[model samples]
Target: MPPFGQGVSVTLEHLFDPGAVAVVGASDTEGKVGYEAMANAVAFDGPVSPVNPSGSGTLFGEQFVGSVTDVDDDVDLALCCVPGPAVPEVVAACGEAGIGAAVVYASGFAEAGPDGEALQAETAAAAREGDVTLLGPNTSGFVVPARDLLCSFASGVADIPAGNTAVVAQSGGLAHVLAFLSRRQDRGVSAMVGLGNRATVGFAETVRYFDADDRTDAIVLHVEGTDDGRALLSACRESETPVVAYKVGQSDVGDFAASHTGALTGDHALYAAGFAQYGVPTVEASDRLLDAAAALGDSPDPDGPNVGVVTAQAGPGIIIADRIQRAGGRLPELADETRERVDDALRGVTYTGNPVDTGRPMPEFGDVVTAVAEDDNVDIVLVYELFEAALGFPVDALSGLAGRVDKPVLFATEGIEEDMAADRRALSAAGVPLFATPERAAEAAGVLARYAGLSDRREAPADD
Candidate 1:
């Protein structure tokens, strides 16, 4: 069922870091589609060759080629920003020019119905004949932050920082939005690709590419619907990197999905089953997509589901505990020795059993956390700290927990002071998944536990 390993001709690197890029249908006309695409591709550090049929003057001062074949320089990638009907010929030309990959930014493909479907078929045929990996026929282009390859017309390409998370979505707009939100949450991704019409490069293949990518540590995917179930599941199963999927389109798929990529609202139940069987944690909320990815990104890979909870204020602590259980996570009973140590650290002021409430912020906050993390029972830690001067949520002191215990600690709090912002940044930069609310912190903890358990099963997968 998974036909992915069958000798794919094009190396993903050509699509990712194509040494020389050619923007087809490029011009300087303001508010024009070609104009925006050219403006965006100009940001690429590699040589960007503008291609236009008019044979007119240069837009960005680079000499324009009347067609892709006319370019003297070697072109590995073709940004097919031409109209839908014209895309096939351009891709064919790129194939003749020995280009292995192209990013098709045109719409009016399958979403436009039969004619669009036919046109998309032609584009697919061209890709096959030329051994090209076409990214999209009706989608936004991709982005690689570390390379400064902002390969899209969408705005806000400059501010994106280089990090470990990677995003692949069916919708281009959603992918960009997720990338932007991830950045806002103080998390940056290694790559962002929009899989519009799966003419050649489908979702499963994209996932596989991310899995092999050295820069990516975690993968976040947005799925509307997919035609190949085994390929998707096989990609998930093969990926050593954890995959967090934001499965959109629950009830009504709406017009955008149908018109945009001809994708229908799939059976959510079946999709959930596949994800669960493969240990892929799926989030329903759009906002939590990146939150889960960021939480899972490059830190404290917990070995078990048993969580140790700590809080300065009791109310939020209780809230986190309840949510953890409700979210199918366990708050393990503190071991006898572990409980005694926690009690001694707190000095018997508050509840010291499982959710250790310190009865107001303590100077021994870091010590108590270390005790929980070191305990035999606890595999992860959920901590809630309010802003108390010097003692409240000490980022530096808590930073030691990740290295000491080798367990993820999700830190949650509210009431940020104007002064402690840098410390907050420091904590996140130190690999602590910071959340504005207790529930989100709980969710992150749950995801970590879920992944750990599933990963163990994956290691010794049950035979069919």
Candidate 2:
């Protein structure tokens, strides 16, 4: 938007891992937005500086300064929790203090009306003049679990565990929701950013930023609308980071999106096509978007859609196979050696043709998974099970098998109970994408297979 690097040279690292952060307009009052922001910032890894016009007291033993200029510290990030009208002034102060970034967590900007639009532009100008990056003029902020920087005012920001998946969303609420859901599933996030208003930094820049982030393994994007789909697609295409996008406004809600953040809801078909062309998968649901990203994070993309499944129970395996086909994936015939090895390992009557049915969870289940993983025809492996104390979830065996193989091996199970907590933790720690349902499993595999196919096409020698 500002010709790449014309201003705001500070990157997302400044926002996520700042040396010191100042909460502008901070309040000691409970249940207030500014207060909430300050409450969260107290957990930041670096020094948390509170800045208020009064600047007369302290919160959590940290003294409040009258203003950013008065802090006398190098503030890498500033959370501007003041009103939208005062954002320009707060930004000017932050610039004067040499702050690199600010999260203007206020609404009533361009999304409000013409007057608000003018205000949003003025705020951006203030940020640019100071060479500071702005997260939102009407947005939520960002959360980095690894750095313990909860710049966001979101409630669920506290308990998020650190992991490799990075989330980027247009809606602050949805960003937090994704982060919460991911954490709940044991697939914690590296960072969750809300590109509110996109006043200065937007999706493409953020995508590129996370692409370079060493902590991030996979990236998930939630897009409401965008002006330049091509640019976004190009950045994603050039990036080695596997991206999963969940773009809303596909069904005649352009007006609402435009009013929401002055965004242009680009044609959904073009977005779909662009993503597909660039080896990116688009999920239809928000939760599924995170699911896919989590799946891709640990599971390397399949070179083809030929999936081999191992089910502790027959029904779930069949369901997985059906869903995989419905999602435009394939189930190729297992190799003779593969089927024979799995058949020999079976201790009971089970189907060992394609989706190797184990009849029930057994210790030999790991061997079955290994047999499938070694198959030359099989590009992906899906393992399904019903968690039971008798079977013990096979954590050690599966964990060991996953490491032995080069291909992607995903685990899916039904049932959730406290008793299974240890097993879940063990598998997750070993870097397995465990889905709660067969549908989710298939959806994740679809992303894996689809992206794999696209990558294969891209690597193929072009027709001269």
Candidate 3:
């Protein structure tokens, strides 16, 4: 909408239009970029045309056009898998054909070295002159969950259900990993794009687009580095939608990182300061990306940094409580009213302070949850248990209690079996979130608290 790369103005409809698509350099060989791009397009359930001089007959049982001009239908996007030397010409043709976007999957671009930089520069110049929005010259491309569009080799494992989260990553591997993690958490994605070598459109543009997107309620980013930090930070600060970023390449890792993604490594301290200044929650670990997304999606704005721990077992509760404190979150002492409520509801042996442990075979686990939920100091409630027990605490009762409370409730179960799966599904259906481990649940709560605190602080008045 606003010139591409200026800010966050691109739209999913503009990016994933299925009116027509052309896969340049479509090949007959299996596992090649051309073949994978063509395979993804064929699986798209929309109109597609393969554009390659070598693909005159047909590929994947569809007719192949020798060139972009030969296709009678208007092309919305072009998947370019051509050689680096041929990219400019192919992009020029797509622009002449009025194609809005081109997803370049070629690798010998800026990531290759100095020669690659020159090639990448030419590619960017062609796109800018032709007015085509380029996705990547060294990328795995993007995917749209609602349209069932899998446009890259990395998206093969992405069987995403319709959901509100949109993920934009700089690494192709991380993008796929995020998608897989989201699926495991029962979280669906609206769209995912890997801005490899970011020749035309950058991560900030996608973030801004997701901010305005009706389908995208949350945005998750995996960034390596960016040439324009100010623009990226500004776009993120202005967006109403929440953003979670996981950055790599903070340390010098020999020549591997540069050759892998062309990311110019920078100081972690600088990146941390930048994130803090812009109110972007930066995650250090990969797993926390999904954790933060799940927690923020389900919870109300956290009122405080205090987390109330509830567990069937005392050991796991203590472990989680320790992790919460280690992550700079407070496990608040139960208020006088809360202690009285828990004492009245549970066995006398139950520790009635911060870590509210319902002693084994407790008669009133539900009432205990109700008491904790009512605590004025508690910003979030975390429950932990193993899946092997025959008679576990009533999760439905806990869900009901959580529903009544203004705070968010997260569960950490022990097993990965069908029983745990059933419990997760049931809790999720009741609007209570689930996590794999107590530590992960605690980490998620910490992130939620951090975001809430940052959001509460108002921005300084702008200069004229």
Candidate 4:
């Protein structure tokens, strides 16, 4: 059976099309969810109509309707920002009007108390009955960066840039934060979906969709909890797309058992075991999320465990090499040819062994990179440097070396301040990945190597 549901597949392109949109409960007041959504839609260069029973005219120079039933033109999406009690009725009207999807932004759902759960259930049932796909009952909604379309009420939409990685986050706030960080790091997003309470759609379905999405190169998930562990695991295991996840709600009770569902499923150990069994990588920190996305998105799967360390300084280089070894990455013995090249580049003062360190004030830094990168034993290369006034290391030359070499190169620099921002930008644009600390760089490399090893084994079902 196919991993996705039987409903019509919704593409990112379909979701962002500006030809048709309806904003329920749209208001002229600022800071309100409906008002913000309509304003964003208007700015998105799409056809949008505001629905408000109190008004008979247009909002933001577009026609206004009192109800979804009044809309004569085709609407691809209905952004419902109505109160929880009124959501079901509005959804039913949209279904009768043939609206394709409903982005329900109201809160009072399963995440709330029992009454909220009933309200969410009624809204979801209405969506099913109306044949409309519901995005959330308490969600920031979706954004398609390439299209410049934003349907979410998230205040941070102004910063996101269009790119290849798509994020599906369960926490509405974290979803917004992820989008902000992506933009801040210059990593673009193709699409973002915030699954609030997940009454109808689940994380597994989103993963299946992303696997088939041609624009998406990688997927990051922020999961709080889920109803069906086995089904989610199965979907991820079957997908060829790389899956990275961060699990929250680790303090909740009954987190490990199969019988536990919803908020009770917060056991960190059980989730870790499930992720390992299915070949899904689980990350803890937010900073690592960005690093993992960058590394996995660019580099090919590792061919072997061998890693080469190239540094302008001795201390940082030694630190990274030791960390790599501790993290399970091998530092193979340097080849004779490589050692000879290093010797010629460094003269006789510095050691030319594994973790090749060229002496300071070297005339040609590019040559040093080429020498270390060309080594036969190196599967991955870690470059560490410290930016200072007296030592003007050839960053461009190092980046050039990165381009020519087939192996993955990770760059780490000390003294990260506003002064080094330009150099960081240059290295980043040149496709030489940068990390703030040696430990983080090595940890990221270790994670990548571990995933590469797992990828070689026969894939297992997620629930196992």
RMSD of each: 2.2, 2.4, 2.9, 3.8
Who is ahead in TM-score, 2 or 3? 2
**lDDT, residue 439, model 3:** 84
Instruction: Write candidate 4's Cα lDDT for 1-464 as tens digits.
Output: 64234333433333444467889999988999888998877666567889889866778898889888788767878888889889999989988988867888887676666887788778877877877777777887888777667888777685688767778887666777888888776676777788776666677777778878877777888877665665666667777777777776566544332122224555677778887777777777766676666666655555566788777778877888898887768888889988877777667737677777765546655576777778878877777777765545467676666446666777777774777777777776776767878888886676666666667432643334
Q: lDDT values of the candidates?
A: 0.81, 0.83, 0.76, 0.73
- Candidate 2, 43-156: lDDT as tens digits: 987789888877576887799888888787788899998998899988988888889889999999978889998998899899888878889877888999998899888776
- In order of appearance, the predictions have TM-scores of 0.94, 0.95, 0.91, 0.87
The number of the candidate with the highest TM-score is: 2
Worst ten in a row by lDDT for model 4:
253-262
Whichever of 1 and 4 has more TM-score, that candidate is: 1
For candidate 1, write residues 153-255 as lDDT tens digits.
Answer: 8878767878888998888888888888878777788998888877788777788788888999889989888766656776787788879887777777657
Candidate 3, residues 1-464: lDDT per residue as tens digits?
33334423343454565577888888989978888778877767577888887776789888989888788877788888888899998888887887878888888888898999999889888876777888888888888878767788653544766667788888777777777778866877877778888887887777778888888777888878776666677777777888888877677763676777776655667777877778877788777887887777666657778888877788888888888887667888889998888877764746888788775535577667777878888988887766654665466676666557777787777765765667667777776777888889988878877776677432533221
lDDT of 2: 0.83
Better of 2 and 3 by lDDT: 2
- Greater lDDT among 2 and 4 belongs to 2
